[model samples]
Target chain A: MLERGEVANSWRHERWDSFRLLTPNWQSRLPGHRYEGPDPDGYMTMAEVTAFIEGFAARSGAPVRTGADVTSVRRAGDGYQVTTGGGEFRCRSVVIASGACNVPVVPPFAGAVPGSVEQLTPFDYRGPAQLPDGGVLVVGASATGVQLAAELRRSGRPVTLSVGEHVRLPRTYRGRDVLWWMDASGVWDQRFDEIDDLTRARRLPSPQLIGTDERTTLDLNALTSMGVEPVGRLAAVRDGRALFSGGLRNVFSLADLKMERLLDTFDAWAREHGRDGEVGPPERFAPTRAPERARLQLDLRGGEIRTIVWATGFRPDYGWLDVPVVDEKGRLRHEGGVVDSPGLYALGLPVLRRRRSTFIHGIESDAREVIDHLATVTLAQRPGA
Target chain B: MTTVANGVNVQALLDAREALKGAPEAAQFVWRASSKWQDGVHSTTRVKEFFGLGQEQEHKSEAVFDADHPEVFAAQDNGITPIEYLLIGLASCLTAGVASVAQNRGIQLRSVEAALEGKHDIRGILGVDSDVRNGFNDIKVTFTIDADASRQDIEALVAQSQKRSAVFDALTNPTDVTVEVA
Candidate 1:
């Protein structure tokens, strides 16, 4: 396998302390793969996660050429020609597991936020001390945004959370972790075909959750109540000032409504299986609503809000791939890991096969499917009498 | 009858502002609402002839309320209930305050939308919990407004409106109520 980054799992090279694997320790690996390292029960840090990936590659004895930085891959004869910064290689099949979060997407107004205010994406964010003296304006209230806002707040920096449309889910609901319910209720087993609106589902934000020692729920309401100034979606930045919309309440309502619907689904499932009694003790976490102001403009030079962290989202970069497997918009077109071009396969995409396809647990299953397809294609193209 | 904007007389508002600037007691106003029970958990409120519009002309609005439950020791589904009216009152009061403050600030507002949500424990209203008060545990008001003003200016206007709103004052403060059999 060819790798682009210096390390195999370069995505884990962040300064975040508590990076919880979405799936628990036991389920966070390939099917036949096992972690013989330390802390098999809890989460792993960045170093630990990197070491784990490196250990996996070593155990499998897979010929991984790291630091190659593949520039382009094109179909050559019956195989493919992969060109990287270092050298070139010919391969029959390729699995694109580079990950979904390759490029950080900042808003267009980021340029107008002024050069005086330090800006950083979660990709390069090391810690709070690295930021300037003044507080921060953390845009996008996704998991990363909330986590950073909370962590920064804990470090004595005032945080203004600009929340938008987000999925609000309790980290632990009904005496069990939410992931457990997702696993037990067969949520991860759902295929792409089962999804009614793939566009909306693909764009849905990761649930508002924080992975701590003991799971804690983090939503806009919770953040606001915890001294975090909640604002609307960022509208624009100009003249050393930032503007925000009055859509905060609407976003909060939508998140609450979605949470209610999700809880209702869980409730129905529990009742159907006669496990309602066990999970019947419902916990109310309704956030207090406040009057939404129309707009907010902050003076960037006013010794307050010295930094801006754009946790908006990410887009995959397929600029290097020279195959016809990608669409006009650069998104890979694949059906259950197999690309339309036959030999090219995609893995670790958000909801590629099942709901957890991009998750650690789901990677193993997706890898198996790709391997099966690769095996079939290789057999068909073998030497004949 | 002279034409008015958003049921507000700007000249009268200016007059009141000026009058209050010189003598604050000159701006004293009183509002009254008379509601009568019609049937099970249903009532009608007649609001008219409020003081301090710079004139004593009669303007009336009749609002009805009906509990959304079966007619027993229970609520009956009819119309907007009292608590819902409370939310409406608070929202409308704050919204009007926002408009007034914006106008006073000379802000050209494009659009203004307000939403209100309140949470109440049914046990309090049902008298099941003697310790619980029969009122909303909390109320949240959200306003989405578009105006050609800076964020600080808009926030200042909202704060000024909240400070000057009569309904806000009444809700936040304790008042004596006299119920007499006449």
Candidate 2:
């Protein structure tokens, strides 16, 4: 979630409805140089996404059960039986769409928060339905950090944003949306077996910092324009103030390291492929990488910082999921979403391809890969199939 | 990252610079890549710095083979590289030595394979501090040899390999890696 949060429309001019574009029109002109799908089928509004499954039931006049939790899953000979809070459903094979950001993660920070301040994650944030009228200190600098910085500032919140390893996405390349190169490169192209390990590690693209206005640095400018103070990494919070690593009066660390690693991996990848055929690309030739030259420092010792809004990043919690698909690092072990364990599939996780696993626009290819790999087998085949 | 208000000390700098002009030349040596001799022996000697990569991102590397010409194994993980292969050769040489000694004594062999990897921190190699470099680091190897030979007989083979492996000799007593720069 923080992965998308940091770069999701980081540009300034991009309103919430910018990606809602379904057709190729002039309105997308300001949306940077490229789009995964310039001619989208339709823009599914937030309401549409929420009501999609419910609306299907409503249209069919079927009685539906919402908020039902799964209890356990077991292999029943050919097909597996899935037990839930409501009832059990049996299927030949099950598709697990539990996204990486599905869980509301709370980092076990060292200190306690003050009662007077407000601290909420992007997960709990439901469209500013109930926001306090106090000053705001937005922790984390990725997509959510920047977005919340913009959102609160626009809504008259005295927001202070702490900048961490802020991801950089080019606004345009010869006047095209950044998404164009992604599509053209093997970033979304499929050649699973042929990809080398180093290339896979270094060439995978990361979603760059997208300003709301498509012009580069628009997101950073937007928050600063709206008076959102960009601070440093968060150290701790006590009373109603904060502290910063830069020896500021009080502040916090903006992002979590895991989130930064995901972004940095992309930086390494863009450099590896020497994006656009530059000799000694960033990944190959260390000097080409922007991060290599960046003298970034995070001093996380703030004397006065209040609430720590952890938009750090999202982690997929597969606790209740009693599956043997994950490796020691709590990540799925597979090739293009094909698990070593039978009758299981994962979707929307990071690093699933040459660079395909990082974006919503690119996730569909993985979905197709999973569906294709599973099509040939059935319940009558493997023991757990 | 804190810069001093005043600039650097010029007298201290000039003295340091002048002292370096009279320094002796950097060491040099011949790097030979030799195949195993008739007795099945090959040796290697590397400086501690190059013995193992430190936790330096600057030294990041991955092995790549052309897709059209596939090899036995290709990866970028902690797998052994060409130099590491010397260790493998040493182990294999030991195995061969043991087999030859035992084969003359009528012990048969079925199969033999050895996979090994070594780990060491760079700070130790550079000799930043005596306490820091620490000790032997670690070496892990899984040698699988199948034959009609019993465990007692294999013990003799192990001893022979340890005694005759020339690569192991260099490891026990490593010659320094010569260094020079223009």
Candidate 3:
């Protein structure tokens, strides 16, 4: 395996200071390296995650070359040539596992913001201390955005969180982690092809969840109660002023309604399996609350907000791949991870093969499937025995 | 399963969606209306033709509608006001979506009724209150649906309808509008 840096470089460098695995430690399963640490129910900090991955590398005894930045991958006769910073190697089959989040996606309107306001994506954010001393505007209400907004507010910084469509999920439900119910109910194992709307499902933002000792739910209501002002999606930036949508109420309603449906599914599953007696009674959370009139505009020149952190999500960087597998939108054109090219494959994409494909516990199955396909193709191409 | 439910042609809807995926540009539509002033807060708008499926198409018949404020606004009581037309559009779109989604889900509907209330201060347009909005402060729609499904299922149907309604999206999200004069 070739790595641009040491093993678990992203975990060590990209994540915020307070970052923790969204999944419980118990779910951190690889092919042969199941998490054997104590506190299986607790979340692992970034440092622990890095250590775990490095340990896995050591124990697996896999041949890995660190500091090998791949420059390009192209066809070379019946094989493939991978040119890296270190050297070039030829292989019959190649698996691109660079991961989905390689580049931060900032909107074009971000350029209109006054040069006075500092801008940063989640990729560059470390902690509140790194930000300038003033109010903050965190765009996007995904997991990263909400977490940062809450942390910044608690640190005595006024925060205005601009929310779009977001998935609201509780940390725990009915005396178990929400992830537990999804896993036990077979929701996470749903195949990509089995979904009704594969396009919508794949594009869904990450849920608003936090991994802490308290295991508290961090939703819009929670943010509001924390003194963090909630606003609509950032619509435009004109004349040093930011315009927000007037759809905050509907956005909150949609998220709450979706959460209710998910909980209903869990409840029905529990009843069908006769497991209701074992778990706590089904409970519902308070509906999200919105401002009577959400503010529609904010002047960047007014010195109210010092920094703007964009948690708008990420996209893969495939600039070095000398292939035609990318689409007009820069998305990989693949059926579940099988590229159209005979020997090329992709991994670690959202719902690439299954709903759980992006999770650590899920990669084992995907990796196994890809390796199996590679073996079959290599065997078919071999000379007769 | 039968392709017909609640009088909706489910197979045709699905086929159209599939076919459009291959020719996305054909799905772009331009609906239009031409209005003529009829004096004193009144006007008549006619709808006849639209562009869709990569060509111009016409309605079965040209439909004319009139708009005017009520007598309280010191104008002759003509037809319903223009704001009322917005409510009509939203209601029609959501109702259609509910029926189509119900048909797709194989839920037989007995009856579906909707009541919509649009609360407008009107002071913004009158220039009496600058803080108030000219449009409705908020609109609420309640659906009383009797179907062969449970209460949660019915609620899910309505929610799904709103999720897919184009008018609802346009109302909730911002859209770029340009006005040009020749």
Candidate 4:
């Protein structure tokens, strides 16, 4: 297999200093390598995660070239031609598993922020110590954004977190990890084809969750209680000032409502399986507290915020892909990992094969399915077997 | 025969959506309204022509409405105020969405009513407080829906309606408005 740098390079480089797997250690399973660590319920730190993946690669004994950077992949004859910095290889099938988070997507108004304020995406962010000594504005309230905001606030950096539409999920629910419930309740195994609105499901942002020893829930409300100022989505930047949306209350309401619905689903599942007696009673969280009048704008030139960390989102970079399967928005047009073009496939994308496809434990089933389809195609293409 | 459910023309709506998918440019609609000053704090707005389907079209009939502030504002009590019109727009948009979504989901609706209240602190508009905003502080929409389905299903309909409502999105999200004096 091709390796850009090494096994689990993103886990090594992209994650922050204290980053940990959002899922529990027990969910860290591959085809054969199941996590048998002592802390099954605990989260794996960045170092442990890299070591785990590197161990998998070693045990699997897959021939991997570490530094072979792929330059282009295009159709050649009946097969495909993959050209890399080191060499070129021809194969009948190819699985593009480079992953979805290839490049950071900052808004156009990001350029309008005064040059005096340092701008960085989560890729460049390591920790609060790497930032200048002042308040920080962390845009986007997904897992990465909320984690950074909380971390920075704890480090004594005044933080203002700009929140957009985000899924609000508790780290644990009713004496069990939320991911465990999702797994046991068959929610995570929901196939992509079974969903009505796959487009919307795929476009959804990551939930506002964090992994810690205590399994704490890090939502906007939690962030607010931690003294991190909660603001609406960043709308614009004009004349050295950053403008935020005025729909903070509605945004919070939407997230809370959705979270309630999910928890209700979990409760129903528990009752149906007669497991309610085993777990804690169903509980509800307080509604997200929104300020009556959230500040609409912040003066960037006033020297209050010295750094702006954009945890907005990421998009795939397929500039090296010479296939026409990419849509106008650069998203790969695929149906359950089966690309529109023959002899091509994808892996490690949100909702690619199932709802759990983006999780580390989700890869085995997706790989099996893709390989099954490949076997069928290869057999059909063979001469008169 | 046209497929009608919950008083919504389901077939036509589906057909239009399907047809527009093939010709996306035709789906770009430019809604228009022109208001003329009638008197102090009053105006008459007319809605007739709009651009859609790659051409300008009429609404079959011209609709005119008068807007004015209440007597508390020391203005002539002509008709509903402009802010009230925004409430009307939001309510109607969501109500229409509820009917359409319910029809699509095959849910028979008995009654669907939406009560909307927009709380606005006039201090900002009156130039008394710069910290206050000129728009409503918050808009609350309560849907009292009686349907053949369960309560959960009814709530889902309203939530889905809000998710798909154009006015709801425009109100909750940022929209760029460029006004120029020519």
> So what's the TM-score on candidate 3?
0.94
lDDT of 3 by residue, B78-147 (tens): 9999999999999999999889899999888999999999999999999998988898877889999998
Kindly report which residue stretches of model 4 are placed more than 4 angstroms away from their true locations once superposed.
A382-385, B1-5, B10-22, B105-108, B119-134, B147-158
TM of each candidate vs. truth: 0.65, 0.47, 0.94, 0.93
Q: Sum up the clashes in candidate 4.
A: 0
Which runs of model 1 end up more than 4 angstroms from their true locations?
A: A6-8, A14-18, A34-41, A276-280, A291-295, A377-385, B1-182
Query: Which candidate should be chosen as best, given lDDT against the real structure?
Result: 3
Q: What is the DockQ of candidate 1?
A: 0.02
Give one digit per residue, the lDDT tens place, for model 4 in B39-150: 8989999999999999999998999999999999998989888889999999999999989988988888888888999999999899998988899878888999888788
Model 4 Cα displacement at B83 (Å)? 3.0
Q: Which lDDT value does model 2 have at A357?
A: 62
Model 1 over residues A1-385: C-alpha lDDT tens digits? 7776655455466445555554445556765566665554455556756776777777788888877898999999767899999988888777888777788889886987767788999887878888877689999888888888987887888888887777788887788777777877777788887996565676778777776656667776677767788877777676787767544554665566557656766777787888867764656667536445433557888878888998898878888888877766567888877888857888988888888887777888778877887887764675570
Docking class of 1: incorrect
> For model 2, what is the alpha-carbon lDDT of residue A122?
67
Q: A86 in model 4: Cα distance from truth in Å?
A: 0.3
Summarize candidate 2's per-residue lDDT along A1-385 as a digit string, tens digits: 1122212212212223222222122222211222233433233343333244234335555444444566666667655677776677777676665566655455554245555555777665644435676566676766666666666667776667755445434434434444554454444564555465533342222332443333443344445666766655554443333443331211111112222333345455556676635422232111111111111122223423333466676666667566677656466666666666677766666656435564545555677668877787644475554
Q: RMSD, each candidate, Å?
A: 19.3, 22.5, 2.1, 2.7
Ten residues in sequence with the least summed lDDT for candidate 1 chain A: A287-296
**Residue-wise C-alpha lDDT for candidate 2, range B18-128, written one tens digit per residue:** 664454232222223322222112222232222211221221443232111113333323333344555666676766665665554455566667777766565664578
Model 2 chain A lowest lDDT segment of ten: A284-293
> Total clashes, candidate 3?
0
Q: Each candidate: what lDDT?
A: 0.72, 0.48, 0.90, 0.89
What is the per-residue lDDT of model 4 for residues A321-353, given as tens digits with 9 covering 90 to 100?
Answer: 998999978899998998988889999999999
